[model samples]
Target chain A: MATGAEQAHGAAAPGMPQLDFTTFPNQIFWLVVTLVVIYLVLTRLAIPRIATVLAERRGTVANDLATAEELKLKAQEAEATYEKALADARAEAQKIVAEARAEINRDLDAANARAEAEIAARLAESETRIAAIRDTATENVRAVARETAVEVARAILPAAASDPAALVSAVDRRMEMEGGA
Target chain B: MAVEDGGGLSIKPMDQFIVKPLFRDIEPGSCMPPEIVEGCLKWYEPSNVTLWMGLGIVATLLLLVVGTRGRAIIPSRSQSMAELTYGFVHQMVEDVAGKDALKFFPYIMTLFMFILFANVLGLIPMSFTTTSHIAVTATMAIAVFVTVTAIGFVKNGAGFLKLFWVDAAPLALRPVLAVIELISYFVRPVSHSVRLAGAIMAGHAVMKVFAGFAAIALVAPLALGGMVAIYGLELLVAFIQAYVFTILTCVYLRDALHPSH
Candidate 1:
């Protein structure tokens, strides 16, 4: 085969050296060696390492996704908590306002009741003083009418002046009739 | 061989495909003819194929091993690329070959990384494309063929032969279909290896031809532009061919695992 290849190469034009059969053994030998080296490197080292790296990457991605999901859930839970707190605060503030309003209304009602009672007492005292003054004025007017009548009778007749009792009785009878009218 | 005589341009595009030993003590511009296998290129000789393949292995290790050495859950840029490749091939194996084929993940991953690195690395200027050689690709393909076939037989025994026997066909045409299936089955490795080597070789050869035209002063700019355009295209082809090869491998593995359809 080597001689045949050499004879073929002896030709003027060697054509495609790839067709030269002599190099086949060398190429095949090295090819086998290269393939075996590649196979060993891959099976023993390269493939496993790359496979591990890939599996790790996939796992890392999945883990990241899971972490993101967890964080999202936690954020939703916090938002819900915040909403409940806000609602509670609002309700508490409303209750406090209502209580303060009720207290203010009670104080106002007490103040109003005290003022009304004091006004009623002052009115009753004023009425009693007016009644007493009216009583005194009525007495004074009766007294003046009696005295003026006596004086007029005496001036009209000297003998009549000695009979004051009869004059007094007539005056009393007239005053009584006026009072009734 | 690039030749210029009497202002006439001559470029041998295929000369670049020559598999010569790197340790040539010969004079510059003169290569030891491949016929002198005595000290020229022995079976164990360190040729350009060895160097590039070694580079491919180093690239494989750099991407897969050292890139992920951080083992960080949050990967670095190179580590991310490493992980992306891992997931890409892993999912491909699982999806195309089935979950039962997960045990073969390492093997599939090896092939994918090796070919992918080799293809991409070949794009470097002045670098030898190890995968462009039929001998190299054929070896890998044959290995896959043998391994998959062995696994099929070991797992399914005589039932593995059902792969070539299409039961869905009409009973009258079953034998004819079986013959076709059998031939196609045997041709899998040939097509597989050839497809990869051919794609790489053609792209590289075309680039070389375009580059050769650059020697002419008149169309130099056009040649350079074409080279740039083809370079961009070859970059795409580099990754796509790797993907195609790996996917086809998965398909073949699927057949081996099931061997019914």
Candidate 2:
């Protein structure tokens, strides 16, 4: 292609090299070569590397997300296990409490039974002792009454005085009749 | 090239757009032409366009090739940028043009890198705007047009022509819409190339105008401020234009792959 000045004196247009067809071949030729060079650079070198980086980034992202999801699931499983273990522990604690309460109630019942038996035995012994004392007092009052009756009789009428045995027999006979009635 | 209409104080905006041979006024003892200049392929003569274009390639390769040499799981800054560009273009092609069009993703990326770097590199002082020239951008646009058209024909057979036919419209309007659609379809390359070139050219021209105005001592500050503002706007335009060009290519590829209407 001829230079802008090299073109025949007045053949080329006065303005706009773009409109000047004489040099179009040269410009177009370089444009094509440049385009081809750039195209080759992009397709063969630049774009592929960029694509690889992009794909790697995507792969990294996907791998990270998958790992995160797996970790989340593991965390959830661990949480469930923790909850279940806590529930088991709680249930075991309740069972232990119920068993302890039952044991305490049994021990309390045994202690109460033992104490009641001892009190009942003590009351029976005391009742027996009281009966014995009453018997002794009844005998003493009879004896005293017999002795006084005899003395009074003797004082009142010496001639009409009776024996201690006869007086006691009479009192005993009257007490027996009243008791029967 | 631009001409000073009034005097030397005035600036010529079009001079930056001129193309020249890389070797100029070379004396025998001064310098020798590079191997590429004297290579067997006489067809491949390096010009200013080729020089800037080569720089654009080196820049692209620096970011994509050398920058990503580490390939660190955690990318370096340049590697990250390269990856971002790759993903952005990859996704655009896959999403807009469908999975089948992913095969052509490299081509889309090439166009994007070339245009994007060309525009951005052009912003530097004394750097040429390769994309601003229809010579460069038109070539890319025509290449996309041809590739997609071929894909359409090969994949969809003669049904590829259905892209121009409007079956949804009423029978009377269908033909009219088809005619309009056909004209628009054929002009894709022209508009595609013109849009990028025009945007870049206009921005540079406006900056030059401001730069020229700044030459006047009275309004130097205002002209400098305006140039700064426009330059900032142009920086944004540089990236946006590249994005627009690439995405439009994807859209056109989509139509070719699935030319239903």
Return the top candidate by DockQ.
1
Model 2 chain A — which ten-residue stretch has the worst lDDT?
Answer: A1-10
**Model 2: per-residue Cα lDDT over B83-190, one tens digit each:** 988888899999999999998888888889999999999999777888988878887888889988999999999999888887788888888898899889989999
What i-RMS does each candidate reach, in Å? 6.7, 7.9
* Regions more than 4 Å wrong, model 2: A1-25, A129-181, B1-9, B22-45, B215-221
- Fnat by candidate, in order: 0.70, 0.58
Considering every candidate listed, which one attains the maximal lDDT? 1
TM-score on alpha carbons, each prediction: 0.81, 0.79
| TM-score, model 2 to reference | 0.79
- The DockQ of each candidate is 0.33, 0.25
Segments in model 1 whose C-alpha atoms lie over 4 Å from true places: A1-13, A63-87, A119-181, B1-4, B25-40
User: What tens-digit string does per-residue lDDT give for candidate 2 at A1-181?
Assistant: 2243334322332456555454566677888888888888888899898889888988988999999999999999999999999999999999999999999999999999999999999999999999999989878877787777778878997654657677678878876687589
For model 1, state the Cα shift of residue B19 in Å: 0.7
User: Considering only N, C-alpha and C atoms within 3 Å, which residue pairs clash in candidate 2?
Assistant: none
